[model samples]
Target chain A: MKVLVAVKRVIDYNVKIRVKADQSDVDLTNVKMAMNPFCEIAIEEAVRLKEKGIATEVVAVSIGPKAAQEQLRTALALGADCAIHIETDERAESLAVAKLLAKVVEEEQPGLVILGKQAIDTDNNQTGQMLAALTNLPQGTFASEVVVDGDKVNVTREIDGGLQTIALTLPAIVTADLRLNEPRYAKLPDIMKAKKKPLDVKTPADYGVEIASKVSLLKVESPAERKGGIKVASVDELIDKLKNEAKVL
Target chain B: MSILALADLHEGQLAGATARVVAAAQAIGGDIDVLVVGEGVHAAAEAAAKLDGVSKVRVADNAVYAHQLAEPMGALLVELADGYTHVLASASTTGKNVLPRLAALKDVSQLSDVIAVESADTFKRPIYAGNAIATVKSDEALKVITVRTTGFDAVSDGNSAPIEVVDTVVENNQSSFVKEELAKSDRPELGGAKMVISGGRGMGNGDNFKLLDGIADKLGAAIGASRAAVDAGFVPNDMQVGQTGKIVAPDLYIAVGISGAIQHLAGMKDSKVIVAINKDEEAPIFQVADYGLVGDLFEILPELESKL
Candidate 1:
């Protein structure tokens, strides 16, 4: 069985985002970029499955500008057998990315597909479910655990209340959540070996998919800042403020 | 224009977020119809009918939708979405899981976690972990959206709407529910609670979480934890309150021993009043807290509990 993992390059999670001066969009000038945190978990899960012999090969695919190859190479260093980069300069929305991945799924014919539940940049948790709908595949999203057993994969999902386990047939979709697994950093030797790995760069037009924008960005601005109040001298003062000043009690 | 809103339910009981989603639908200025899809969802459908501004309630009762799995639910919504101009649901786990599939099947883009409805097609949503807010406009004919319930006020139950049974039954052979382990608690749900007290990595371990119980019981508050606490194995993921976890904005939020990260602040910063109790004076939690008490939580928890 083959595993196809979709990775995305986004602004680093640690960076404080600054909106552009003209309010057109977020400023990406000289910003640090990295693979999304959730995508790292997805890659780790796929590599672990390959180590366990449940997956015969692990293929990593990413969609972005040409610079996205850096993330695919990182996936290769983490243990993906190969990488594919869908080159697109236009900002690919979730639907466009899902359509591209559905095309890739058709060509690769991987038994399992994995993606990050949401991207840190857009914070939109839509790609995996959209791809599932487009490809007519069952989906186990927000998965913390994936167990492959005899043509069925049992996925333990993290729900709002607790955990829910569901079983899906082969050739399904699974989105990695936060607690899925702790991602491993690539070693120096592996990083060197990743440079020699085969990487295929293709355009969205190559797969007959158009990367078009459906949502227009009208403006971007900072949220209202919550100002900190005075520090209480004692617990009694805190209670007094809550009961009398704020009147929330 | 007609709008279809999906109800959020658990164990046949309607979730409070459904009312909030309806509130968002009402903002769109349309005839709102709520859809309840589940096994034996008559009670939930009746509850949906009572929400203000709802004109009708559509119920699809079937075993296939018992878990409200995305596959069948998405198909059912696609079938029922011909004349509706907008489809809305709460940005809960169920909505986040299913709405995108419906959007894709309809070939329309979905605006997720919409915090403000600027117009019929424009919305304001947070990006970059709530660091920046982006106003977006969708050109798609059919608008699909998931509402951040905390941003909208829940409507009161006043109007009694008519209930209609949806006869469309979707067949599913691709997936099946194996089991579920939901935490049973007497406290109000964190998302809908009036008061919330959350702990973090400073609690040390799972057993230490018991300290918050006394204060919680006294204030009638729901207990939550930061991602650090959940990731540290001090509590379950369901109790997590952060960007990727439950987004809660209660009337009063108290942070106990929580050194707030930005992600954690994103979930509860909208709270009416925030109180922070942590040993670290430099903790980020104090930045957003309306009242700050810097001290040891071990000593503060008991005193806070007894005083309340």
Candidate 2:
């Protein structure tokens, strides 16, 4: 079986983000960028499947600007055998991204597709399921554990209340949740080998999917600031404040 | 334009998030029709009919809808989606589970977890765990979306509308309903809680999470954990509140011992009031906090409990 993993490049998880002056977008200039952390887990799950012989090949694909090649290379170093780069500078919505990925799945015909439940950047958490929907394939979303037996894939999803185990057919899409697995760091030797990994570049139009956006962004203002409250000296004082000042109780 | 809003029901009652999704539909400037699907959900459908701006409430009651397995629910939504330009649900487990399948069945893509509707086709969503925001436009004739309830207020109940009971035939036996392991907690549901108290890796061990119990109990707050705490196996995956986890907007959110990562903040930054208690004065959580208490959580939490 073959597995396809989708990765995305985004602002580093450590950096503080600022809204642009126009309140229309994030200030990406000079920001530290890295592979989305959850995508790394997706790639890790795909690579681990390959290691366990559940998958014969693992291909990593990314949809972003040319700088996204760095993330694709990161996935390759982590064990994806080859990489596909769909070059686009525009910020694609989850639906458009899923449409593009669905086309790629049609062309590649991978048995299993893995994606992060949500990118650290957008946190939309829609693309993988959307891709699954577009392809008419079964989906195992927010997977904490995955077990493949013959033609069935048992996926343990991390739900808000608790855990749910769903069995899906092969040729399924699975979105990796946190705690699925810790991604491995690429060893120095693998980094050198990743340079030789085959990386294919394509355009959104190449897949016959229009990248036209439908949503209009009116503004991108900073989230409201929290007002600091005084630390009450005692529980009784806090209660008094809650009942009198805050009136939340 | 007409929009379809799936009213989420749990135990024959309307889920509060359903009202929030209806509010989002109102923002899109369209006539709203709500679908209440569950077993014996007539009461819930009637409740939905009372919400302001809801023109109609379509009820799909069946045993299959009780568990809300995505396969049948998606089919039902797709069937009801005819002639509607937009379909929306709350970004809850049920909504997330069913909407994408509906989108795919309709051959359209779904916009997931939209924080705000920019236009009929455009949306503002947090990307990269709220570290960055992306504005996306969908061109599909029928757009499917999941609204972040935190970004919108729940629909009020004043206007009364007619409740339309629509029967659905659930096809597709390819998928079977499996057993679920829902975490039993007395605490309020995390997504809807007004106050949240979250522990972090600094809590030391799974047992140490008990330290947060008294504070949470006093505040009637939902208990949450950082990804680090979840990673350390100190708590269940559902307790995780971060970019990749559950995004919440509570009136007051308190972080205990959490060295805030950007991923962790994205999920909770929309909170109205943020309080951070950490031993390290330089913890990044303080940057976003409305109230910062620089001290060890072990010491501070007890004091906080007693003070409350």
Candidate 3:
């Protein structure tokens, strides 16, 4: 069985993003970019599946501009047999991305697909479910742990209340959440070797899927910021403010 | 436009988040309908019917929807989405799980975590982990939206809408429930809690989390933890509050030992009053805090517990 992992290039998690002065969008000019943290976890799980001999070959696919190749290369350095980049400058929504991925799956016929639960940039958390629905595949989302046993895959999900364990048949879609596994960094030597691996690029039209963005970003703005109050010198002072000034006590 | 809002369930009752979603739908000026799907959920359905501005409530009581797993529940939503021009739900785990599937079946894009309903077609959502808010306009004929409960106030119980039974069941053989371990807490739910006390990596260990218990009980505050605390095994994952974890905006949020990483701030920064307690005076959380207390949590917690 082959494993397919979908990765996305997004803003680094550490960066404190700044909204554009015009209220159009977040300023991305010269911003540090990296593989989405959750996407890294997805690729890590896919590579582990290959290491465990459950997957014969692991393929990493990304949908974005040319810079997205960096994320695909990172996936290769971490251990993927090949990389497929759906080269598109258009910022496609989850629906269009899922449709494009469904087209790729039709041709690749991978037994399993792993994706990040949500991209840190968009925080939409919809692509995996949309892909599963479009492809008519069973979906296991927000997966904290996954185990493969014969023709079934057990996915333990980190849910709202606590945890839920669900079993899905083979050829399924699983979206990785946190605590799935600690992703390892690619070694310097592995990064060099990743350049020699096969990396293919295709336009969204190559899959015959329309990449029209369904949502128009009308405006962007920073959230309301709360100004800091004076620091309390003692516990009694804090209590006085909470009871009298803030009235929250 | 006709709108359908799905009632979120919590412990066999209609979740408070449902009213917020209904309010968001009503903001667009539409005939709002609500769907309650679960086993023995008539009480939830009744509560949903009482939500102001809700015109109708559709209840589907079945074992298949007990957990609202994505497979069958998604199919059920798709089946009921025929004539509706808009579908909305609280951006809870169930909403995140099922809305995209319904949108895919209908061949449309879903707007997740909508914070504001600008028009019938336009909405506002927080992207980049609440660091940036994006106002988006959807071109799809049918819009699917998952509302962030924190954005809108819950509609009060004023209406007496009629409740109807939905008899549609889609066969799902692809996935099966194994088991669930829900964190049982007698304190108020984290999202709706009046006071929230969260610990961070500084708490050091799981046993130290008990230090907050007395104060929590005294204040009737829900207990939460930063991702650092959860990662260190000082608390369970469910107690985590951050961008990836549960988003909460309580009336009073006291953060202990948390250095105010952007992720943690994204979850609780919306609290009406934020109090940061940390030993480091230069902690980033102090910038967004309404009140800052600089001290060792171990020493301060004991004193504060006594004072309370």
Best by TM-score: 1
lDDT of 3 by residue, A137-173 (tens): 9999999999999999999999888999999998999
Instruction: List runs of model 3 lying over 4 Å from the truth.
Output: none
Off by over 4 Å in 1: none
**Model 1 per-residue lDDT at A59:** 98
Interface Cα root-mean-square deviation for all models:
0.7, 3.2, 0.8
Question: Distance (Å) between predicted and true CA of A40, model 1?
Answer: 0.3
* CA lDDT, every model vs. true structure: 0.95, 0.83, 0.92
DockQ pick, better of 2 and 3 = 3
CAPRI tier for the interface of model 1:
high
TM-score order of candidates, top first: 1, 3, 2
TM-score of chain B in each prediction = 0.99, 0.94, 0.98
lDDT of 1 by residue, B233-273 (tens): 99999999988999999999999888989999989999999
Q: How many backbone clashes does candidate 1 have?
A: 0
Model 1 C-alpha lDDT per residue in residues A162-224, reported as the tens digit of each score: 999999998999999999899999999999999999999999999999888789999999999
B11 in model 2: Cα distance from truth in Å?
Answer: 5.1
DockQ of 3: 0.87
In model 1, the clashing pairs are none
> On a 0 to 1 DockQ scale, where is model 1?
0.91
Clashes of each: 0, 20, 0
